[model samples]
Target: MHVLVVYESLWGNTEQVARAVADKLGSVGTVDVVDSDAAPITVDGYDLLVVGGPTHAFSMTRAATRAEAVKSQSALHEPARGIREWLNLLGRPSAAIPAIAFDTRVDKPRMPGSAAKAAKHELRSMGFGTTVKQETFRVHGYEGPLLDGELERASAWADEVIAALGLGSRADR
Candidate 1:
């Protein structure tokens, strides 16, 4: 199976989790890990899609125009870019593929289910099957030293995805 893992990261915590997911998913099949900024991804070539982002101020970032003309004005209104805009720009996949959603967020003991919830809603609206489920990797500080052992946790999560999806060769079992 071919899997594509795409992500957006402000401070690299999300990137670390994306890498761990890609690495673990690769253990079962071919995987391509991409930064969401690299546009025009061919989702038709892959069997699984994994989307990830970071939670900022309890919401996913809102998409914005790049030109300076709207920057100041949009900054006041939009704030951040959400994966929904990115997926919308990419358009819906040609075929419905199973997908997993994830995010990296500050481990505030109080804050719960913001980014992952947003990601799942966006992905389901895009017409992907909600098989792999939404998950979160922890980040300690804003810039993220990354909660220790989160990568391993991500790998373990991916293993569950593989088993649930029945991916991997016979030998992999």
Candidate 2:
């Protein structure tokens, strides 16, 4: 199966999670990891889609950035578009193939939810089934030193996604 993992990161934390996810999917089949803002991906080309981003101020940071871009008419350092807009424009994929969503955030004692939840909701509206509950990996600081064990957890989560989606071993695709 061909899987596409697209992500938007502020301080690289989200990318790390994306890579770990893609690695696990790679074990089962072909995987492509792309920046969410690069271009709108055609979901029809892949069997599964994984979308992720970073959380800032309790919401996906990329969404605010995209909004800023639209109002400012200038490209911002973050990106011009977000996963939500991309998925909305892509319409629905042919199959109900499962998709997974994840995010990276500064672990705050006050806040529990992550940006991935919003992304997952948007994906569902766009007609993709989700596998493995939405997840969040923690970061130590704003610029981020990802918290310990997050990568391992990401890989493990990917394994779960594969299993939940009924995908076979890596070699079988």
> Which is the leading candidate under lDDT?
2
Candidate 2 TM-score, C-alpha based: 0.85
Query: lDDT (CA) for every model shown?
Result: 0.74, 0.77
Q: What TM-score would each prediction reach against the true structure? A: 0.82, 0.85
Tens digits of lDDT, candidate 2, 1-173: 88889888655678889999899888778998988787455777788889998765566665665455335533224655666566656767787877789888776454756678988887787678864699888887555678999999999999888878888785663
Q: Cα RMSDs of all predictions?
A: 4.9, 3.9
Q: Tell me how many residue pairs clash in candidate 1.
A: 5
Q: lDDT tens string, model 1, 1-173?
A: 88888887766678889998898888777888877776344588889888888765565655533222135323222313346566767667789988888888777654755667787787788788886678888887555668889999999999998889888653766
Error of 1 at 139 (Å): 0.7
Worst 10 residues of 2 by lDDT: 68-77
Q: Extract clashing residue pairs from model 1.
A: 61-80, 61-81, 61-82, 62-80, 62-81
lDDT of model 2 at residue 152? Answer: 97
